[model samples]
Target: MQVIATAGHVDHGKSTLVRALTGMEPDRWAEERRRGMTIDLGFAWTTLGAETVAFVDVPGHERFVTNMLAGIGPVPAAMIVVAADEGWMPQSAEHLAALDALGVRHGLLVVTRADLEDPSAATELAQAEIEQTSLGRIEAVAVSAVTGRGLPELRGALARLVAGLPPGQPGPVRLWVDRSFTIKGSGTVVTGTLAAGALRTGDELDLTGVAKPVRVRGLQSLGRSVGEVHAPARVAVNLRGVDKDTITRGAALLTPGRFLLSDLVDVRVHGDPVAGLPATLTLHLGSAAVPVRVRPLGADTARLRLGRALPLRIGDRALLRDPGRHHVAGGVTVLDVVPPGLTRRGAAAARALVLEQLDGVPDVAGELRRRKLIRGSELARTGVDTATFPAPVAGEWLADPAHWAVLQDRLRDEVERHAKENPLEPGAPVEALRHRLGLPDRALVEALVRAPLVTRGGRVSAGGPAVPGDLIRAVETAFEGLGPFAAPEANRLAELGLGPRQLGAAVRAGLVVQLAAGVVLRAGAPEQAVRRLAGLPQPFTLSEARQALDTSRRVAVPLLGLLDSTGVTQRGDDDRRTVVRG
Candidate 1:
């Protein structure tokens, strides 16, 4: 299905044309029918060729221009109606300006009431006006809803227009609600044009501004209930948790955790000069109309602080209107959703220089270059495809190549400084280095480790101070005279100058193993003890093992505990331990 919105002057037969095409009344209210004017948005649908085309009929009067914008905001295509007798009018120009500001390029020009006068003049005039806007040189059709003249041609043109539209993209859902109401026996029902992504029954959707998520109790398209519906169609979703009053127009149903609700954004203006725009204006995007404060950054770039948070992304298009003047001031293409603060002197000008280079297209490389470091999920939320970018520094944490190189250099410097500051404990704790570099995750520090640097036991080391040659040889000689498990006592260690610092260096260099605070054993002593114990009768008591290795209770106890912790031995409930022979 494809949705098309109607736009024109107040009495230009926009609703009449839709009614004639769909064989249904486009105006729903009895007062509107009685008054022969559309005061609000109306909906109708018809099958054109093999495709179902939904029409969002909007009011053309100046007072309800806001309602017109709401109806046309979410639809992809449009039919700009102009009465043949009236040619072009003020409201026609205003509606055209709105569409142009929105950057809506796909549409058809319909010269309505053709039976009343020669439609050629009106057709030529409307075409000439449209040629100057984004909807350049669209297909034009002259039709009379009264006599049904040229109705078939209009339908064929609409069919071709819908066929030529770009295919709906699959991604996180952002359905802006245009209408919300309660149904008898059913909860709240919100209807809108599903521009992208699919919706399924029972799907949990996040209602913007609502604390809790709402469940999709049911789904309907073109007045028929369905289990699921995809994009480019008009859908009415039955919600379970939210009330009708809570989920009003402008409220959006979003894919939870898939969007970034931003109150401030930097944008590139299309229609009007940024310097001339008012300080405050109404911003229309999707089905939302929000008041915003504009801060001009450049001739065509500015920052907009919205009245409320909206799920915005890069490349999204919207319009700004001067509510006092009752006219669209300009259109905006979102350049940056999570923009940097412009608090410093000349910061706004500098940011404008950067924003001028952005074309409002989501480019992974360009975004990474600008942001330096960002989460993959954040990139996705801002409409960037992380899969197309380079590999991340750590899990989902991307860094620009140049920035990553700088971080690596800084990490090396920090490690070297840490080693010099604390020679006895040369290795820096991973958490300490992470905090020093202001890195968000410890894994990033691990990823930064390179040659001459190693991570072990939660510390990053730059190959700590080497054990002294004399101390190494002396410790080896002292161990050679003792049994495998006969760890040196504190007095013996002191005699060999094997203090805590020396023992720490030796342990890091694999010269000796320190089992406990005061117990030191030769390297490979635990393995040797395990082998000796495996030959014991299945399970041996601690005393038996101590005697077997000819070591005291202190050395034997820590050795057995180390073996057990390393899965080389297991302790039984009987106070006996067995070596794990594998």
Candidate 2:
């Protein structure tokens, strides 16, 4: 099924034409029929040449232009009505401008009320006006809903118009609710034009501004219940978990996590110059009419601060209207949903320069280049296909190749600098490096480690300048002179010239381990002590381990603490120590 909206001036026979084609009243309210004018949106459908076509009859009065915009925002095709006697009218031009702003291309120009006057002049004039907009040159038909003159030709033209429409591809569902109400037995139902994707009966969807997701209890298309309905169709969804009073027009049922709700957006202006637009204007997109504050960045680009967060994407076309003046300022193509803040001086100008290069299309490579780094899920939320881009540096963390290379170089330099600054502890902690680099995840830092730089035991280091063999040998010879647990005193180490730097080098080289200040032991002394303590008994006191190792109290305390820290021994609350066998 395909949906089309009717656009024309008030009393131009738009509803009459729809009723004549579908053999059903397009207006639902008795007041509308009694007044002979459409005040709200109405729906009617008919089968045309083996294809189901749905008509969203919109109000053509200038006062209800907002309602008219809501009706045509999601419909891809339109039937622009022009009365033969009236020729062209104000609402006719306004609706046409809206369609052009939204980029609606497939439509038919209908000259209604043909019996009142010759429709040739009106058809020619209306066709001429449409040729200047996005609709371009389209099929034109003259018809009289009263006498049914040229009705067959109008239907044939509409059939061809619907046939020529591009097939709707399955994608993230964003259904803008035009009407919301309660049914007798059902809880709540929302009717809208399903522009893309498919809706299933049991699918879960996120309703805008609602805390919890709503379930699709049932689905209906063209007044018939269905399990699933595809895009380009008018659908009424029976929703669970939300009340009719809360759900209203302008709220959308969206595929959760697929869209990004943004209050600030960067857009490229079309139709009118940015300088002519007011600072505050109403933005119309989907079925929403939101007030916005505009900050002109360039002649064609600007930043819009919306009153509320909306699920927007790149390349979305919408209109900006001056509600006070009752005129459309211009059309806008969204270039960035999550834009940078313009707080610094000249930042707006710089952003405009960058936005000038964007074409409003979702290009993953372009996005990565601009953002430098972003998560895969965030890129997807912007309507970009992450699969088309290069593989991420870490899990779902995409980085530009050049920027990633720079980060790797920076990481290497930071490690080298850290070693130079603090020779005793050369390696930098992983968390410190992550914070220094402003990386969002520690895994990214781990991925940045290269050949010379290595991460081990939660520290990243470029294995600090290999300890001099002479210094390592000196430390080893000093330890060999004493028992395995007999660490030399600080004064004794001074005699051998084993200062903190020398001891640190020996530790890095695995020749000696510094248990604590002034407590240096051979590399394997902790393990050896654990083995000796394990033979003593199930649990031994620190004094008993000290006696068994034959070491002084200073050496024995740090050694036992080291063993406990390294998981080689467990100390109970009673101050008894036991070797951890496993």
Superposed Cα RMSD, model 2: 2.7
Best by TM-score: 2
Ten contiguous residues with the weakest lDDT in model 1: 463-472
Candidate 2 residue lDDT tens string, 468-525: 5568667866876699899987887888888888787677768888988768888888
The residue pairs that clash in candidate 2, if any, are: none
Q: Model 1 shows how many backbone clashes? A: 0
Model 1: colliding residue pairs: none
Model 1 bad stretches (over 4 Å): 464-582
TM-score of 2: 0.93
Give the distance in Å from residue 269's predicted Cα in candidate 2 to where it truly belongs: 0.8
lDDT of 1 at 90: 95
